[model samples]
Target: MTDFITRFAPSPTGPLHLGHAYSAILAHDMARAANGQFLLRIEDTDLQRSKPEWDALIRQDLTWLGLHWDGPVLRQSMQLTSYDTYLAQLAARDLLYPCSCSRADIRAALTAPQEGHPHEVYPGTCKQRLMSDRKPGDALRLHLDRALALLTDDFPRFVETGEAHKGTHQIDPSQAHTQIGDVVLSRKGEDIVAYFLASAIDDARQDITHVIRGEDLFDFTAIQVILLTLLNLPVPTYHHHRLIRDDHGKRLAKRDDARAIATYRAEGKTPADIRAMIGL
Candidate 1:
């Protein structure tokens, strides 16, 4: 058996902000402390937003912060074939269906007030439709009901080692169906692979034993756990650390260039300064 393996996956959509630094440093330290391997994965799945320059800057920023990854950095762009294979497998099991609804359509369909969540819960407009029934531009969605039925009485659960919520949480299918809804596995055009699908598959493919990321993603872990279970992939322990927010208590985004590590570097802030800023 291998030692604990973890990864720091970042999209190259923009500059590496302080939040990125904190997460990367945390993942690196954890792997180093355990004498395990820390891997870097470039989540460049969004072909429209992801840029090669940003990808290069990500590496440079991590290295500047004294965080080094083991092995060659895994680029998601190079693994489209693998993603296709997994998607096909899910389709073969009848766990996936074609979704033709747009964001406007879903919002218009869901007339009832929704609870506060990070993402908008998708209304099941295309749940009954199969791939054959889909039009040319239809996207793919997971049949949540059918997928959960596969578990039957044995619902999926995962261990959370993060400070905020640490325990084995049971995934209630009823709550998931209503709250989470049927998430999109692919878009109408351009890149076919979705964030959840790609990350889940990559984690299993790299034999990642632990996933250390921001707490914003904590709520969505259940969805990924479900997908992993459906695909017969090994689920890893999760540690979602506290997020770094601005003065307004808003989570740092890639566009927060003022708080970006590169900007800090330009201002002659040392690595220790960054560590102090993010409370690492």
Candidate 2:
């Protein structure tokens, strides 16, 4: 509990489930334990999926769990300008390029059957495209190769305090090249910010000392660290907590309405019950 400035940032695309409860409670409890700050951020950057009702429901669910924050909630939609400002910074260093590849286009670009995760590594379809060539309906992608080359020193290793990956971890240059190819910064057809860029900027802006999130996001952290380093922002310690899974051992998702916090509340479950359920 040396540094406990953490946040519970949930996308307002759907309902908050038991998984959300565990993350929110864990962050809140950690901050309280250290007499530190806990912040809430509504990650409603997916304009197409984000809804006002879902945002309201998220607040309601967290409140019912008895969690409190130090200051007002910060919504990412209002921080569009900040995202743009940072994107421009990357562009200034020639570390960004315009990409026009759709999912289908990217798949077609691959010469072989790629395994593991979909969009695991971009085929670099639009790497040749320049900023001046950017047009509507094109995504802005990070030139990861250039970005890594821009690093003056070794990629920063971050400290993890969560049950999973609880140690110091560093990123290897070779792994980034073959696996995490140029990731999209802004979406096609608009200036919509992607998760890594927006979250990095928000964390810096909030002065967040630690990032507490699910291990599902553990792999992509290197990209965020890369972005933070290039932008010359302080990188925080990351704690990738274990995921709350269903009876089948599959991790919970928002679609699991049965596990939604609201559903449990309707069935008369208390906050303490939730703590026991998630093995707090």
Strongest candidate by lDDT: 1
lDDT of 2 by residue, 1-280 (tens): 3366889999897899999999999889888888899999988777777899999999999999999887999998887777887888999999999887674553232211122334467777789889999887777889988998877477767777877678888877788878677887876544367887888889988999989888877777888899998999989989888889999888887888999999999999998999899999
Q: TM-score winner among the candidates? A: 1
Residue 34, candidate 2: C-alpha displacement in angstroms = 0.6
Q: What lDDT would each prediction earn against the true structure?
A: 0.84, 0.82
The CA-based lDDT of model 1 is what? Answer: 0.84
lDDT of 1 by residue, 1-280 (tens): 4679999999898999989888999999999999999999998877767899999999999999999999999998887667877888888988889877775543232221212334666767677887778777677788888889889889989999999999999898878887677777765555547788889999999999999998888877888999999889999999999988899888888777999999999999999999999998
**TM-scores for all predictions:** 0.93, 0.92
Show where candidate 1 strays beyond 4 Å: 103-117
